[model samples]
Target chain A: MSFINVLSREINCKIVYYGPGLCGKTTNLQYIYNKTNPDAKGKMISLATETERTLFFDFLPLALGEIRGFKTRFHLYTVPGQVFYDASRKLILKGVDGVVFVADSQIARTEANLESLENLRTNLAEQGYSLDKLPYVIQYNKRDMPSVAPVEELRELLNPNKVPDFEGVASTGVGVFETLKAVAKLVLTEVKRQAG
Target chain B: MATEPKRVFGSLEELMTNPQMVMYEEEFNQIQAIVVRLVKEANARVVFVIDKNGQEIAKAGETDQLDTTSLASLTAGNIAATGGMAKLLRENEFTTQFHEGERANIHIQIVGNRVILVVIFDSKTSLGLVRLRVKKASEELNSIFEALLRKVQDPNRETPFAEITDDDIDNLFND
Candidate 1:
């Protein structure tokens, strides 16, 4: 949930990055952590297995300036994308203010992406949340990969609702901020909508 | 206070069902006071409160040497993991956790099932003493947050976000 601190003039919101295994969910967070100014970011914490796969989640907190004099902090998290990590994935979404579904565009990973999407919907539903109602965006990551599917095909599969979607190579940082900014804007807009 | 079954929801439901976890200045001061007192009463190095989602609500004591943001996030994860295990074991909720180190230790308690109360201590205090202090502090903190929730539910409460415009949001990322 969004934590609005009137005494501190700050707003903290959670945004979760989710997708299939090897979909570059952690990569997106790493890129953001690296590029963020030292002052605006907290230390990035990754709870990973010995193999470097996210065992639980990856967390990065960023202060993206202010809105109407309130400092805005977004705690960005990425679920371990492996199928067996469904429980961990569900936990990461506990207080999410927004979501970025980072679909690996490779032709071979389409099924994994769809399964993860369905898992997202069901897990969200269990928490009394509907994906259709949350501030959400989609990113077709790994656009630079040779075996990736066409953006059009990926959109038909994942972006049928046509939320703001980006073509990203998260490791290389292309479309990273665009996807983040889109969801962050949507989340703030959502909080504004609630404010009224 | 009658115990209510805990229901976890994300921001969407949190906004629609209850208000966002909006902290009023009045409630903030009360919470800060409780935290400050708890540190001294328990002979602890640090005492902080966080939402189940890992947002640091308030804290007091020797925190200058701590990365509280990371600490807050990981603590939540630890609780979430344990809470999952609780479910698998058919328990209502674990509600309390303790981890001991040679020099520093932690005690986590789920307060009213809404927030996590964490105390970090050292060899200076006994676990029994910390637990007693936390139990008393949890009740007080719970009442304050309960009042804060009710205050936020008032539809007419003034929020700075109400005046924020689309342009204002856009300008934040203009760089």
Candidate 2:
């Protein structure tokens, strides 16, 4: 749910980074937060367990740039991917304008990826949103892993809609901004479509 | 802003997905006026009108020292979490939340079941006064938003993004 403040000349949108546990969703946000210019980003807030697993969500607000004259601010968030946190994930998607499903590319996590994808669809549906209609993208993260599945395999399993998928090693920031830009672009384009 | 799942208007997709809330210049001033007036009537240190999604629509009173962006996000999260709790207990919604701090207290109200109205104050005012003022402010805010929504959904109305070009979007990533 993007908020367009005509008086303020600001467009605020929410994008959620979602995947199974330990798929580098937090790392993806951390990388973006670390590399972004201070003026472009706000404080990154993480609600996590003592061991650093995301407990609720991680929020990073970015002022990407102006679209025409409206300030395009994207609130980047990552859900706690642990299965039991389903309730939390649903809460975060309430007003989402875009989605990035960060898949762990390791062969061992293939089932987890599929299950999380199903969960994502279910949660979005609960909020009156469908994955196909939303501005959604997929990232095959952890490409540096030795046991990673081939990109072709990840695609066949994850990118059923073929929505601007990317290959990323989030720790090193590979494909991080590419994924962000891809989904953010889709979000803006969708906003325009809604207006038209 | 309403914690309840939206009641579909035309298509469920066209319902909530399009413009969840549109802030035009007209209603913006009315809403701002209510927020500003609430601060004075409630004797609040600060007042913020935030949508359920955490976008700060308007604010007044002393806010120079606050991290409003972060506060907006966290407040939405707080409301959503409590909304979740309400569901499990089989309640309609928990429309009001109060958090007392030693120095500054926070009062959050769900107005018209659509937006969050937050008032931050200290020892200068009583909760009774704040609540009474918020009740009046919430009614005014609700009517203004209802009008804004009616204007937004009118098929002939202009869209803020209608004038945006492909170049404008591409330029966003040019950095």
Candidate 3:
């Protein structure tokens, strides 16, 4: 859901980054935070354990260029990826406008990816949302890893929807904006459709 | 009002563009004047009027540079979550809350029975003054908003989004 301001002619949407543990979910946000123009973003807040994995979520708000007359803002968040933090993940998914499923491309983490995806479907169902129906996308992350699964195989298994999937090395910001833009676009389009 | 459940708009745009578009220049000015007066009367450094969904409509003092959007959204989320908690506990609603920190204190009150009024202040303002001022402002705001709703429900009002084309929306996706 979005918070709309008629005075400012703006809409704010929440987009969540979700995936399994150590899947670069937090890293994606950090990279974007580091590279974003200072004027375009607010302080990035990370609720993390001592080990640096997200505890609840990581929040970063980005201002994309305006659409029509309204300034489009997206609040990006990453859920704690560990299985034990399932409760926190469900809490973060509340009121989400769109989702970016960041998958660890490493071959060793294939089962982890599948498990996380299943968890996502289940949690979304609990909240009365469906992954297939929502504006959802997949990001095959950590492409730099030599042990990562091939893009084709990852697509076949994870992105059957063909929603704008990206091959990303988030730490270096290769496909970070691409992924962000894809989700932001989907969210804004959804807003327009809802308005009409 | 009837006991029928309040509708939940699935998205921000939907809520803003609902057939019940409730705003006009006169009410807008009235709201701004009331906010300015309320801030001064309350002796507060800042005062903001956030929509029921937590979108900042207008603010007075110390708010020009702040990202009110994020704050408004979070406030809305907090209120919704709190309201849900109240229902779970079989209560009516969570009316208000106060948070006092070392350097600053915040008074968050629900106004117009729909919006939230947030006053951020320091030692410059007293709690008594803030409460008295907010009480007065809330009543005035409540009436103005009720009239604004009637204006919104008028059959002659035009929609802002009626002119937008699908291609324009698609262009937003062209990265």
DockQ of predictions, in order shown:
0.51, 0.51, 0.20
Model 1, runs deviating above 4 Å: B1-18
The sequence of per-residue lDDT tens digits that candidate 1 reaches over residues B1-175 is: 3332223455553554444778888899999999999999999999999988999999999999999999999999999999899999999789999999999999999998788999999999999999999999999999997787778877678785778898999898788
What's candidate 3's i-RMS value? 5.4
Q: What is the model-wide C-alpha lDDT for candidate 1?
A: 0.90
Best by DockQ: 2
- Candidate 1 lDDT at A160 equals 81
Cα error of candidate 2 at position B149, Å: 1.0
Instruction: Residues A1-196, candidate 1: write the lDDT tens digits.
Output: 7889988999899999999998999999999999989999999999899999999999999999988789999999999999998888888888789999999999999999999999999988877677888899999999888998999999999988999999999999999999999999999988877776
The alpha-carbon deviation from the true structure for residue A152 of candidate 3, after best TM-score superposition, in angstroms, is 3.5
Best by lDDT: 1
lDDT of 3 by residue, B15-114 (tens): 4333323345567788999989877888888888876544466689888777676676567656756766777799977878788998888888887557
Better of 1 and 3 by TM-score: 1
Residue B85 alpha-carbon offset, candidate 2, angstroms: 0.9
Candidate 2 has which clashing residue pairs, if any? A1-A95, A1-A96, B1-B114, B2-B113, B2-B114
Off by over 4 Å in 3: A3-7, B1-31, B51-54, B64-93, B110-115, B135-157, B169-175
